[model samples]
Target chain A: MLDAFGQPQSLVVLGGTSDIAGEVVRTLAQRRCRTVVLAGRDRDGLDRSADAARAAGAERVVTVVFDASDVGGAARAVDDCFDAAGSVDMVLLAVGMLSHQRDELDVERTREIVSTTYAWPAGALTRVAARMSEQGYGRIVVLSSVAAVRVRRANFVYASAKAGLDAFSIGLGEALRGSGVAVQIVRPGFVRSKMTAGLPDAPLATTPEAVARAIAAGLESGAPVVWVPGVLRWVFGVLRLVPQALWRRLPG
Target chain B: MPERTLLCGWGRTAPTRACVLAPEVADDVQRALAHADARGTVARGLGRSYGDAAQCAGGVVLDMRSLAGIGDVDQVTGEVDVGAGASLDSLVRATLPSGWFLPVTPGTRQVTVGGAIAADVHGKNHHVDGSFAQHVAGMTLATPTGLRRIGPSSDPELFWATAGGMGLTGVVTEARVQMLRVETDQMLVDTDRFVDLDGVMAAMEHGDADYRYSVAWVDCTAALGARRSGHTGRAVLTRARHAARDDLPPPDRHRAPSPPPSTWLRAPRRVPPHLLHTLSIAAFNEAWYRRAPRHRTTELQSMWRFFHPLDGVADWNHLYGPRGFLQYQFAVGPGEGAVVAAVISELADRRIPSFLAVLKRFGPSAPGPLSFPVPGWTLALDMPIGPPALRACLDGLDEAVAAAGGRVYLAKDARLRPELLDTMYPRIGELRTVRRRVDPEGVLRSDLSRRLGLDRGLDRGLDRGLDRVGD
Candidate 1:
């Protein structure tokens, strides 16, 4: 249950080790959020995130083993997370993979990227939404990317996965309307996180904290969609109208 | 489960969305409190607090109205155990037929028992009977931990904290209140018109003790003209007391009339945005002042007319329009009555249009730390949120009030600066200590608490935790 000030008492993060997810939990903990459930595969990374959440003010930090790429086990994993943490006020789905452009055509890499970025998340989130609808109140935050607006050749594989997830999340929000469940889609142009460390800086690049703040505010204000830099929504609106030749010619 | 909806106080300003849940029983309240998310939960009752005290943005709002049940009244003692969600109107209807009335009631009977306690609301009879909490013998508070029955004698600290605690301490489930015995449902009101502020103040200071209820409706607009001639603060003073059985007509003297159910006049759901502008309000005030007799004594008036005239016009707040209005009410100690005069003059000088300002003399302050009244004078005025300088002017008045050892009523405050909170309420730290004991995790929170920095200690705890992790 979110309080009158929009502070949640407990939060369950599916990709708990993600930089953006950790930042969101830390911010909420600072505002007196007492319970945090971190679900991820990396033990050491999960420990670090749990420690940060406790330091940020969470009274209890529960870490659960989760593998987002285990598409067949997604439903069980989500159910386990909720079973461990009763009545979650918010569930953040911040899982994705950035396969190299050269590996885009490789069958195995393509299958892995699509499975990790979209297939497993969609499977798990569907289960999460069902549980939320049963309880009649919950917020699900899906981290998409600006790449989904118009898939450039440089990151078409990752963009396509995000495009599928983004559309699914929006439609899911509509499906859950009046059921007391909400799905917030967060799109960032380029976030300065460990995932994008080696990539060249993109225009309107933001930090994990910035993305976390935007997500927190969006949930507080009950906004359906939030853009990290905010201006990306307008930027993408114009990019979508550009001629195909001009858009394709643009450098990465 | 919580449903998202926009809620505003009686003043109708700064509407915010909250996930509202109506809990039917004490257990429901406990479950809701246990699950309330980070934003925190605050209990709401009748929404009569004039400001955001009852509203919690983005958080769960426990609508206690579902807890409505009036228990058997103690015939010998005039004591009753009433649900916190039960409105004074309902209680009055039930108890009045048994020859009893509320110990203290504000200008309206629509307020809930929980709201009355949360505000420690003062009625026109404050000089005689104190506030609503003074007569409350015991109560059941559903805190984040669990439900606990407390009273003034048992755990006085928690009891006083919950009283005027603004529903921050916990959600009041039920209260054992002592009702006042009355002979009739009518009042023998004495109406007097004063030509200047000093005249009315002098009359109240000298003769108010003679009556159980007294209030003055000052014409702020009329004072503007009087200010130039060195005379100001013209008002219409009405003082009254419960009429005795023999005071009524000979035919009706044997029995008290049953109080009327409040279906008098219904205000339109939506009025023009600027219906109560300067010209219109001024005209209304002028006519209202002139309409009262120069001096009338022992005039027989119904309980509805004397105590809650505004209740007749349901949804009167909508008349202020879409922009809404702010009810700026402040209290100053004895010898600081000039502060009231200065505020009225200032509002008039700024060309700020205010409806009839209510001026009342407070007898003494309650033991509750956050209670708004004190031994002196209090004035409440309604001004539209149109003037560009309205915010600045009110801010200035806040400083002046604080400097004079006065405080703005939190129940009616929407814009008081957080920095001035401690100065206005010196005992806030003590209240915080008591609050933490009841709500250790800070599960109970509201928009007003966030706005006034009452939740600072919760954040401070986070900083402390971070320090420990660093060590």
Candidate 2:
């Protein structure tokens, strides 16, 4: 169960291989989170994250195979993960594939990015929300991006997919208001991780650890949406109002 | 299916949704218990608990107020059978006119009889009369298995467990309580003002035994703006005894015992959020402390004025505003009064403003494993819930409290961590054993029980087993 501080004692990380997700698991483990269920596609990466959690004071660590490419299998994978660890107090959704930057949209690349960033995640989250509502109490933290606030010209496909995910998460939270289940969305500007290894750093770029801290704070405060560095909350407020003519000229 | 209702404790924090069913009869309670799902069912009364003790998320909450009925008081024995839903206000009104009063009334007379027993509430006179359960002779409890009439002699384990068990034992349908006989509705109260924590502590230790009721109001905000002496625990102490018929003024000598008075004022339903910050609370504290007479003896005051001062202001908790407040009350053993002092100093140093801080000396604890009070000092403070430092500050205090062999009162607690539950209540295993006996299927649970991990021993043990596997 989550304590009054909103710290969960047991949690499931859907994208366990994601750097931000791994850091969150380790941080929570140190904060007394005992049981960890890490589900991702990479076998070796899942093992590494599980070991990190175990060393960080998690008493029980379980790993499950989950493939974002197989959107149809999302619900089944989530069920297996929850069944492997009964009575989970929290679930962190942190799966995404940053498509290679290109001037012209490739039909297949757009499809892959949308599937990984939006469709599969939304499917898995819907299943998790249903299970959590039945359990009577749980917290769901989804790692979105500042790009979701307003899709950029350079990475429109990835940003637009995130925009869809961000909307879905907010809507789901409102739907589960009285179910003793809460959903929190984390929007980080530019996080340094494996997925963005070679990308040019965006303004207000942050690290995985910083994003983890923001998630912890957001969960504690029961905030519906949290922005990394916090300033981005205002930064995006202004960015969203910029005229289309001016926005198009801004560099990525 | 009944529509879910959002419920919060008196402090109005951590609200949860539950299917609240008003049970008019014992049969209704039994039916609800039998039909309870895995999320579980618990009983609720006037909801005076400061936290989640009465709330069960996504489960059934049997509203026992429908069964409220006060039986005739035994003229000679002073024992009255009361339905769990009956409020102390109603009980006092029924019996006080006949020269009898509730033996243990909390600061508010609004709590139901079941809530009083479930929380085993104590009042200014706890040092003399013990908690509410001490005065209860017997009660009928509705469990998932069946209904049972239990007392100190018949099913002593269940009886004691039901007391201060936070309703996890079962839903108390009715109880026979032993009220105290009094001469009048007035009290002869003595008031004293102290400039430091040590002065009041010494006074209470030596003088509390001489009075039937005693309590001290410490100015926590005063501690923040410490005087040159660096004394942070300035306080106003009041001790009282029932005013005999002859003690009253000439014209009122022949007056009959009256019921406790009703509220004279009510806080508005809505107020601006974060209205009671440090500046405002500090000013209020200063005015309150200065208003009390330095030393006054045998001042005749009404029962309501003397015992339930806050009750005179209806919904006074609303003054804390939309975000609500947290009442942190904890008790420590004798010779550990320094822990109380340390906590006051810590709050002062951290600049965390507390509006009302009450200090009292407690008598020996009751038999209930989870009963909060012991033979020692207990302090309760009310703080609005917004400070970023508040959580960690209170966490540090919890560690101090556990180390000092003390425990936070579950009824008023909203944020106590689970790891220290054993250290705080060593006999919790006994509670779990009795609970497993009465509710083996775990059909009885509350948000407090779940948050504190009070109802999941087997699951916790399984985690320990997994720990072994990992090793």
Candidate 3:
């Protein structure tokens, strides 16, 4: 269970191999989170992340194979994680793909991006939520992006998928009200992690360590939505008001 | 009119918004229930319950403070019909002057009679007198169905269910209680300072029956204090009995037995930042342990000073800061004393400071299925909630307590899991049955009931998630 300060004793990371997720787990483990469950498709990456959690002072670490693109198996994979851990106090949903700018007509790639970022995570989160509701309390932290504020011409596929996740998370928080379950949406501008290592840094770009710190603070405050740079909340507020023609004309 | 209000238990955690209605009379209680929306209603007193037992979120909370009155005491029968809203403080003041005292008084006098019965609160004298409900002669209950007068003899099932029922049975409007007769408003207390947990446990087990009231204050920080000096788990044990008038010192022989004083001091209204911590609490514990006399017998002390010392400071809960504290209280049977020792050791070893750790011996429990006390020892620990290690520590203790056939006090609980409720209290099924009979539509619900999933049917799943997060 999450303490009054919003630090969970045991947490599960859906995309355990993600750089941001690994950083968050290590940070929380140092804060006395004793149990960590890392689920991802890469066995070697999951092993490495689990070792990091152990070295960071987690008393127990469990890893399960999870392929987010396998939407049909998403719920089962989630159940396996929850079953292995028993009662889960928090879950970090960090599964997403940052595909490069591509033709809209590349239907196969679009399907995979959408399913990995939106459909699979949404299905798994719904199952995780049900388990938590039955347990009577839990916390869920969903990683989103500033790109979700408005889908630009570049990387619209990835951005639109994050937008769907952002909306779902907000609604989930409202739905769990008074039920002792909470959902937090974390929107980072641009994180210099494995996913974006080769990409050009966006304005107010941050490191995985910085995003992890923001997530820790957000969890402590039980904030519904967290912006990594803090300034981006207002940045997005104004950006959301930009006219479509002007937004399209602006360079990436 | 019902007004939206945020309410929490005495520990001051898990605050939830609810529509509150102060019901001055019995009819008002009925009206509030009738007008209650989809969210049900529950009665609240001074809200001394440590958790959400009295708080129904997004629902109606019938504030019973207005149902206030004290009937004329029946001096011959030693019985009094007191309003549910009448606090033990007021009742103590009124009756102590008449040489009649409550049979059982918890650590605080601020608790309302309704709350006392609802939680079936036990005092240091529980080993002899049982809980508050054991002394209840009869009670008037306002349920969703209608008003019903019940008592242990007349309706044992509902009467016992209502005791420690956490207000789910009904809103107890009035109760006739049998008070104990005392010679004076003073206590003849014996204080013994023990060097460790075993010394105190042995003394209490052998000697508690000789005294009417017994309690021990354990200095949990002494595990660290011991390494500095050589006293491990030091504690101060006090056992007391009502003093006869002749026992008083000659200086005040002519004075009449006085009422207990109201709050003489108040805690800070706003939380002071990091006011309590391991170092500060260790210092306090060391001082407290040293302050007690090595051995003192027949010391004359005011009843309130002996029983409700914390009452001297009002709003003391604020000292824990804005996050408040968690009061984890659990009881284990005779052979389970090892669990008690283990729990204290765990806290001491972990350096998790508990400002107040009370140890008491309990007699046979009352008939209430949910009554916390059983036939052995119980400990109550008050710890501030911010420590990252606190939750896992408590969760581990919960398993230990349950494994030893012990159960945590629901009144003092906020985070107990649902799966272990059955293991701890097998008779809880009986409580569910009684609640169903009285409130079939589930008109009474609280955050506690919802969290424990108490109102739901039996056949509870035992598949609990890993509650214990170790080192």
Candidate 4:
């Protein structure tokens, strides 16, 4: 359902999805969404995801193959998805990787870590965010982390990476303001998913299913920030103000 | 700002605003009741009720006055459909043409049909007709469960509950009230006044059964030695149901008085903060003796002019000025009446002069949970408004009344403390149970409710238990 301008008017996410994007899709669906373009890198994963989404009751789902690390073509890739569908209603920036913590101590490895986890995704999403702003009716959802609140000695590199991304998401949302384009930032704590398999459970860690619910609820509630395992907002609030000596002694 | 609804009782005097709904027809009453039942609102009548009985504190009072229609009068059966808010004056006028009258009239005709039913008011005729509830043929009450047309035949428990149920049972919109066929608008004459207080009681007790109407007029301003004009007047409408049809008068027709001189109004005395004291009261008593009458009764009086003389005064309360007077009307329950009477006499002996004294005999009490009447003697006395010292005197009366197992009238009270009220009426919790069932959403309320915390909405027995513990 492409317009004469050949831009997507709506979008959807199939299986390889971000929690916040799934929520934004559900919100639009409730409001009677008509056309949607589903974009992801894996065609098979997208098709499989589409089947589940159609079952969960999305009216439409389409897939676009792309590599987010290829920043030069990222903006063009977004336009193609809209050209294939009708127009873009939402662009969910849920692509990221949690680099190996021990590998980050190596300077050369840290550059790779920063590129995969931050630089490319940041640059690519900014281009997509601007495209949506030009469309004049768009929603950009960015996945953030609670660790972005403060960088600790143990996870400072990961925390710092998230901190930069969080600031980018917030600043991007503000830039889109008055353009009729809105941004939603989701901040989830340690969430259990296939990506986090084989790792010990973190205190206040939440499951993917829990994160999904929080995402959808946040979109419906129009919240600026979200914390999974909901009470952690308060839990982390207390953690931030405690005397440093007392805080360091408390095991996570 | 959004406002919450509250409930008002007959004894409370505070004013509050909630949405007001006055149902006009049965169907309207039903719809309002259903809506309030589904949601909730307090159904109230002519805010004439003394306390919160007609108000729902923060809630709207469903002003029942809109249901003021007096249905077709049954000249044959002496029955009439009275809209809940119809005043007794209107009902009497509408029905008297057919030679019928209210089975019982309270001290005032200004009371609405619904208010009378709620209070189950009685007059000098209580010894004969019992409370007003006894003569109610049927009533239409709007409850949480739609409209229930009830009477002795339909849902007897609820019927009894609605009779003297105060407004808690539901909004009683229209009632098939039984009217008595009267020989005339005028009552058969008889009057005998006593010189002393005991003579009045002795006369009422010895021969009250002989008269359908009996009452006493006391010179409250009489001196200690001579003012206790223990004088009681008694009368009965002659059973000879023969009225010269040619002279048939309207219901409101009654004898008029020679207007008292403006100076006759003692209210101008300003009731100084200390005027109600022992010596002042004694002095007033001495002056009352100067205007003497040992015993006497004027004959052939119109029933309204006799029972409800206040109806003629327009705004009689204005006579008491901005400081509105408090009428302490209490009756002893069974053996308690004697103690109350003794207390009243003692107050006079102590020089606390009551401007008016009305004594009557109550029949077997109504089983309504919070019905005020008991099987004993009752007295209604009025006192001019004054300062704190006078309040202390009333508090003393309250203690004695509560001690004697008696309660004051809620509709006539303005300053009674809650402790004595609870002591007098122990069935408040029981009444609240029915109130909640009738209006689950907690809507019906009035100003009086806020004063005494009647519709407090919380059932924390710890407070009650604590009060008992403190006692």
Candidate 5:
């Protein structure tokens, strides 16, 4: 819950080890956010995030094992996180995998990328949204990418998965309207996080802290959509209208 | 179930989103409290508080308005059991025909019964009748432990703790309060203008006791020329009392006394931000001071005109524009009245525009530990927020007030420092002990509580001993 200053008391980060998620949790903790639940696949990584949050003034830090690829077990993972924390004021869905487009020619690799990026997260967030609705209030912040705006050939498989996740999150937000739950879709141009480490810097590359700040401001203002390096919203608006041939020729 | 929504106080500043649930009954409130998340829960009434007292931020806010249900008034005792959510406006409308009125009403009647009690609001009649809590007989509170009935006699400690407790103790569900009987709905007013702050203070000190209600509007922006003639901080003082039937027109005298219309006018949808700048406010103050009669008496005035003039202008807060404004109100004992003068002069020296500055005299303090009123002089002013020096000026005022053994009204505070809580309310430790008994886990909290460190744990051994003795 957030106090009158828009400071949340407890937060549940699904991809706790992700750089963006860590930054968001750290920022909130500094504002007197007391409880933090970190859920991720790596115990050591989750411990590191929890330590950082505690140092940032979090009173309690709990870590739960979460594997985004375990589609069938996603709901249980969410339930475990909530059960450990009691009631979570916010849930950040920050799990994503940027698979190499060349490896995506293999059907298994494509399925893995799509499932990890979209199917699993979509299922987990749907269950979390239901709990939030039952609890009467919760903010679900989904970290989508600007890649969802247009699927470039260089990273077509990853972009397509992001597009699907983005559509699903937006639709879920609409469904949860008036049910006391809010969904904030974050589309960052290119955040320099571990997932995007090996990739070349994009035109409007941003840092994890910048994306975290955007999320914080978005939550404060109750903005439904947030564009990190906010000019991306307008740039994408124009790029989407470009001719198909010209759009295809543009490199990543 | 609660829904995420933006909540702000009357000041319309620093809005925060929260999960708000409008609980229609005591049971609903209890259920909501039970299920409140880690951020805890706080009860909110009409949102009339000028600051963060009602906002819980990220926590569940129980909007008590849905619980509004006014029971029948006890004609013999003039006592009524009103739901915590019931607004004073509705109470006035319901009781006026029966020749009864709220014992105390603040500048506005939009406040809820719970809010009136939690804030222990004082009115123009404070010098004569005291504050709202004095007339409260008893109340039912939904505590984290359970629902409990408390009163001055039944449980003096807990009752006083909850009174002006800022909803930190628990949620008040219903209260039995005594109302004053009135002969007519009108007031026979006496208006007088003073050339300077000293003149007004002397007049009020000498004559205010003659009337049941008195207030003075001071102009803090007057120039040095006015001061040279002993006319600095010129003021208009109004004193009034409920009119007798004979005081009304013959036609109105024969009819039953009725409450006035809720609102007579509304402000425009939007007011330009610059409309309330120093120049405009200064002009308004000058005109307002000059317009009042030099001296007049036996003027019949409607309740709306006499009691709540600003209520007529709906969304009047928007006049301050998007940044909103702050209302800084402080009270110092009668001996320290000089502090009031110093503050007004400070504002004038800084050229900080205050559209409305009111000065009043309070008779005595309520028993509530955190209650604002004392036998003192209180000054309240409204100033826009953008001034760079406003924060420092207020901080300086806080120090001056503390040094003078005065305190700012928590109901109107948004920026008070935490360390000054002990200085402002010396008995806060007692309130904390009582709170531990009812809400040991601190499930009931608000943004104001966190900001002031009001929820910090006390000596555990002492608290446990108190709890055991009570049990």
Candidate 6:
């Protein structure tokens, strides 16, 4: 215990109030983490998230809500947000959006989905990873989609977007393997989140609570990849055998 | 070395909770050198040095006092090899019976030989022996290359560089430092009093050269017409050393007896200064100066009692009454003697009154790049922190000092801005260049480095919108 030590130990969380990010904030409290700033757009949501994080455990939690949509050269703003974070340890990017199956069919809609799902998280996490690596140790979590494994016509746009993300996640994990960090890729089949509240349930659906639990477990174990339903790894293995034409007819 | 950790009653020099390291023998010191991974490391015996000189912020501070196995002593030549971590008082206690003594002892004997060499400490006798560094004939300072032995002649540059390098150059282990053959464990003394600021400066310059030891005490109360020679100076010059039979100098004067980290703060808390005013300060000063032994010549006095008279009180820094105090010590070189007089007169004019004013003559510059000594006169005074006015006064003084080509001591600094440091020490870049060469990755970092902008690495935003002003 560093109770006898006088100086404070600093920490930075990248994903600004991401559920898993929030949990990490709570976790480091036992180690006496002094500074925690959650960055995201939803001030109300982040405030609630930080409150929940503090309630769980955190010494000093802060909020720096940001819009990662790159509205006006968003990369510059994201970079600026990082400078404000000051010596960040982990950047939990929980800013991704999920598009409905029908609306994502439009090219314009698909582009938005692709950027938010894959491009924004990828660009930001890479920067965060590079910084943490230089500091000697870093922890990052890139939430990927299991729909990416075998795309069906019912959800091709969403699956296609996640496909790009899944590839980037794996590559980042490999790149950061020995960089004093263990990048954890969480593939939860379906999480009943605020976005999916009125939507129909999918197979092996996990509650946000369950997803948070699996991610916390994976991060602590330094696991390379985590499948939320536990059986999806095998189910996806079998789904690979399905022909594309037949797979197109199945309900997502 | 004592078996307990000590702090001054004010927690300065008294042992508090002592710890004993497993016998650190030859192998321990050698292995420690290999184990340490930093830009540079310094051995710390007792953490008694006035400033961060003993505190390695981002670097390692090897506790040399832990290696306390005494070796054989040469009675004829008065040659002895002591552990680096061993305390000065312990060394003195062992050598005194044999009529041998450390040639130079600073204000406190609690400091380690390793620390003394690292800081190049000087005592009242500095006008004679120079400093502890001059007495060190040979040293075993660990470096990246290996533990190499060095003397004044063998690579003299590196030796002197390490002498006052504040442990930035390398880690000092055991040293073959020179010692003085003494008549006894006593110091013969004389006292001279000066009525005014000019009188004090003249007295020190005219008479200090004739004696082996010299120092003065001045009253700080800004009382009109009631202070020391209006800023009095008390000087002592000791030439004869006491015989071997004199009682051992009281155990390390600076040692803290308990855990009183903020005695300065605690006392002020108890007796808040809401009642203290200018008149009160004047009354206190008058009482203090009246008690001094004026125009007295002592037949004999212990070296510790004579030079470090204040050490007996422990944590005397607390008497400043808690908002804490700033010990502003600056010396004016030959060309800038007028700068010294100007500063003193300015302080007097403002009625800021110094409770502790000391004047000393610096003989020569040390080898370290940033060591704070120049040939001329230096003055130090303790000011009880007050308000915005205090900041203004210091700012004004800083400008005057800079104009006079004078510099501030890094060890005692509390509120210097990053920009001023660059101007004060033009050679700061040279030290930074040496730092870069030693550890290019910039792993050796501290709050001081960040505050002072030491490694102003490429701003990450330069590639993007570095143009944004406070965006």
Q: Taking chain A by itself, what TM-score does each prediction score? A: 0.97, 0.97, 0.97, 0.79, 0.97, 0.82
**Residue range B1-471, candidate 6, lDDT tens digits:** 224221211112111121223326545655654654432234556655433343322234456667654455577766677666676777777776666677788766767787777667776666665777777778776654456687788866667766655565556667875677765556567766555656667777787787777776655455656543454333222333342333334553223222112112222334554234456766666665665556666456666666555555544555544344555777567667777777767776677756556666777766555556667766676565553355457667877877777776554443344456666766665555554444343333322333344445423211122112123
Better of 3 and 4 by DockQ: 3
Q: Over the stretch B235-287, how does candidate 5's per-residue lDDT look in tens digits?
A: 99999999999888888987888787767677675777677887777778878
Off by over 4 Å in 1: A1-252, B222-232, B460-471
Ranking by DockQ: 2, 3, 5, 1, 6, 4
Best-matching candidate per DockQ = 2
Give the TM-score comparing model 5 with the true structure, all chains together. 0.72
Reference-based lDDT, residue A219, model 5: 67
CA shift of A212, model 5, Å: 2.4
Per-structure clash totals for the candidates: 16, 0, 3, 60, 5, 46
A1-252, model 4: which lDDT tens digit per residue? 111111122563422354444544554443334445566677876676566556555666777777655656655665665555433545566666565557657886666546545675577677666554333345566676777775555556666777788898888777865554556777777877765676677788876667765665554334567788778889879877888778667765
Real contacts recovered, all predictions: 0.00, 0.24, 0.09, 0.00, 0.03, 0.00
Model 2 interface DockQ: 0.36
The 10 consecutive residues of candidate 5 chain B with the worst lDDT sum are B462-471
Which DockQ values do the candidates obtain, in the order shown? 0.03, 0.36, 0.12, 0.01, 0.06, 0.02
User: Please, what is the TM-score per model?
Assistant: 0.67, 0.94, 0.74, 0.54, 0.72, 0.55
| Highest lDDT against the true fold, candidate | 2
Measured over all alpha carbons after superposition, the RMSD of each candidate to the real structure, in angstroms, is 9.1, 3.4, 8.9, 23.0, 7.3, 17.7
Instruction: Note the Cα lDDT for every prediction shown.
Output: 0.84, 0.87, 0.85, 0.60, 0.84, 0.57
**Which docking band does candidate 3 fall into?**
incorrect
Tell me what TM-score chain B of candidate 1 gets against the true chain B: 0.96
Task: Give the lDDT of residue B408 in candidate 2.
Answer: 96
Q: Tell me the tens digit of each residue's lDDT in model 5 across A1-252.
A: 443233466799988999999999988886546779999999999999999999988887999997777899998898888877765678999887886758668898888888889998999998888777655467899999988988888778888999999999999999987655789999999888888888899898999999988887776556789999999999999998889899988866
Off by over 4 Å in 4: A1-252, B1-13, B30-40, B221-293, B296-298, B349-353, B456-471
lDDT of 1 by residue, B1-471 (tens): 445777778877655667889999999999999887665789999999887788765568989897879987898998999999999999998889878988999999998999999999998988777889999999999998889999999989999988888998899999998999988989999999998899999999999999999999998873335447543478999999999998999888877559766667777888887899888888888888889999999999999888888887888888987667888999999799989989988988887888979999998778899888888999999888776557668878998999999999989987676678999999998778887788888877776786676776765322222111111
